[model samples]
Target: MLQKVPKQYLAQTRNIFHCNCKIKIPIEFSEELLERAFEVLEEIDLKYNSYVSGSYFSCINENRGNWTPIDQDCVEMIRMIKKVSLITKGHYDITCMPLLQLWGFYKENNHSLPKKDELATALEKVNFRSIAIEGLNVKIGAEQEIITGSFIKAFAVDKTIAFLKSHGVADAIINAGGSTISSLNDASHTAWKINIPDALSKDVFKTGLQINSQTFSLSGSIDNNLLIDGKKYGHILDCITGYPAENLQTGVLTKSAFLGDVLSTALFTVPATIRDEVIAELKQHFDFDYFIIDNDHKKIVTECFQYLR
Candidate 1:
């Protein structure tokens, strides 16, 4: 049964979910419902967070050569990850922990860059094909690790929204650090307005978004890029080159936060020469809305995005 909170009782809480990002879920302020939301967050962190010592991803990394048992939920996540990696030509890889470590993003308070030799060594172990998932089992290469830096937070929000909706808690929003947004319904049954941030100049425009039944994800080098010397390097690295991806920023609105997360990263990392083909291939699985700024600062705003405005 749904306990309806009075209109005056609307509230929200923030907590550190997976990836150390705060998850803000707006609710009707029922104590039991609030606790249930926290429980969902806790469950996801314990089972799938790679940073956690005993999590399934950690177990898979520590025992790379051996097949590690995974839960069905983990299996579903991996399957989606594999599909994204494949269609993007390995640009959107889950086996990216080594690359992150080499680039100094994996560790806190570290600003070191890897030497050429060290970069080469790490690149040798980075490949999506190295990860094999069958049923509830997963195996990686001897040194490969799957890092969900791009997807885990969104996954957590998606699941939390699912839990809320099941409890008759509709018409809410889940925002994770202003990057991923999940909605059970439009903001109070109105268009969920959003201002698309400009990647280069950091300007905000008046024409925002009106979203419904969707999760929106935006990826860019500016938000989380590394400034090494005079060079700007994106946190997103190419699984093939083992280097930071080219200058790019992209936004995707889709039915699933998992898909939006993967697609946004993939769009940012995939080679520009063949990006359209990859997007075309992705369409067979999902038709989505996107906003992309290319290396030349050329904005590619799809029709789907314009229609939302």
Candidate 2:
């Protein structure tokens, strides 16, 4: 039973999935301040929207071979996504558009196991490495299309926070569809308390996953709708297999929600033999922290989180 709290405001402006958006700011702010925040969400709905076939990114996908030009914001986002993909060792990729179309997740159609030959062909056309950005110019292989399903949610949080900060609202929390970004501690330094939901159950978060001014993103299969023949199928797909990852689910918390989103998606696809190496690489590149739910449903926290319990 997921209940809405006072700070929650949901609108169906985006795609069909309920965007459980929440925001909380100090009481000192005026009505105009809150209105500005709402406007930011609506503005994002018009641009960067996945449902609209004519969006900037969508048009790039349609004209796959053309030198599709992109705005600075979109370019910056793609650049950051690429950097994170490198750190994740290709576990998460945004260039799986062909495979996504075959699976029919976007159109709410029945899920079927794609033919081996067909999926292989789709995979051939789907490689993030093929898409390159040069300043504001975007280039992709003639057969490939770009899809930002993995990064868009977290990016939205980033953009929303920027909008809020620009309006002089220094203290706030924005949670959109389970992805969150925030500057806790009110304008006067009072802390904000947030509940981190238990992965096993939605009853309540056992303890808080705190942040003063940072981004946090969680990706897991425990809460997905891939029910086929009484078995569940998750939304996170393995770019390697062109199939949903099985057995393990992962959650990553980082200074940037965009990176967390990629790591969670990528780590889920890493084969058991190389998971340790991937973790080691993450440690080397960025100050990242993670919690992995193993095949046996055991929770293993990274070295940075030993005191959470």
- Please report the candidate that would top lDDT against the real structure: 1
The superposed Cα distance between candidate 2 and the true structure at residue 188, in angstroms, equals 4.1
Residue ranges of candidate 1 with Cα displaced over 4 Å = 1-9, 18-29, 107-115, 186-188, 201-207, 307-309
Which pairs of residues collide in model 2?
Answer: 91-266, 92-266, 226-233
List model 1 lDDT by residue over 117-164, tens digit each.
Answer: 988898888888878887789999988887877887788888888888
Residue range with the least summed lDDT across 10 consecutive positions in model 2 = 8-17
Using TM-score as the measure, which candidate wins?
A: 1
RMSD of each: 4.3, 5.1
Task: Give the alpha-carbon lDDT of every model.
Answer: 0.77, 0.67
Model 1 TM-score is 0.88
How many backbone overlaps does candidate 2 show? 3
Please report how far candidate 1 places residue 6 from its true position, in Å. Answer: 13
